[model samples]
Target: MDGISHITFIVRDLDRMAEFLCKGLGAKEAYDSAGNNYSLSREKFFVLGGIWLAAMEGDPPAERSYQHVAFAVSQSDLPAYQANLQALGVEILAPRGRVQGEGESLYFHDFDNHLFELHAGTLEQRLGRYGMGR
Candidate 1:
């Protein structure tokens, strides 16, 4: 495959997820099914950082886990994302320990039990830091 075409999330409330995407994560709504089932069920689409993200109506996972999708973010904007997610009442997960130069990360769970991470580092940086085995 070339790369990720899109990421689809199974959510319960489209409106709520929309708010979380648009307001919390700075995503732009590309489409909304509006109760029209063109595919498997009702769905909505959003463009987040030039990536197509789909939110489909369905039963979310029953348990919360460490499984998550991470997005690249600048260090300066990390605090703003944290504040916005907190203001929206989203559950913020404690960040894991990290060595210097690996960069910062913010972890949180959405209403549908989907965990997300906003990371401020690139793979090269992470590998470089890890190479020292500190």
Candidate 2:
């Protein structure tokens, strides 16, 4: 109830998802079964900048959409992050138009087509820009 406790992503390959989470999202591997004795299914856990993320082996989403989870980032780091993601061969999507003072974002997709965003703005800033007092 305080904040998001964890997020679970159903993916096709556990290793691939782990790689994306680590290399792209800067997540650390907290737990990995490595196909060890598991009860229900293959799964791995990571701490993405302190956010719990679990990837369980399974079929990916049926179709791609704008539905995505965005991580907060610093505006100065955005360019370098874009370059890194480019080097990793992540699919970069055309950025949406942004109003000044709202902040910036980098939108992209994982190899399996799950969309993600790295936003360089705070909730307070956005609310202020939108004329909603924080």
Winning candidate number (lDDT):
1
- The per-model lDDT (C-alpha) reads 0.93, 0.86
Per-model TM values vs. the true structure: 0.95, 0.92
The C-alpha stretches of model 1 lying farther than 4 A from their native spots are 132-134
User: In candidate 2, which residue ranges exceed 4 Å CA deviation?
Assistant: 37-39
Which tens-of-lDDT digit does each residue in 13-121 have in candidate 1?
9999999999999999999888678998899999999899999999999888999999999999999999998999997888898999999999999999999999999
lDDT (10s digit) by residue, model 2, range 40-131:
67889999878999888878888899999999999998888888788788888899998888889999988777899999998898889989
The top-ranked prediction according to TM-score is 1
Question: What is candidate 1's CA lDDT for residue 95?
Answer: 83
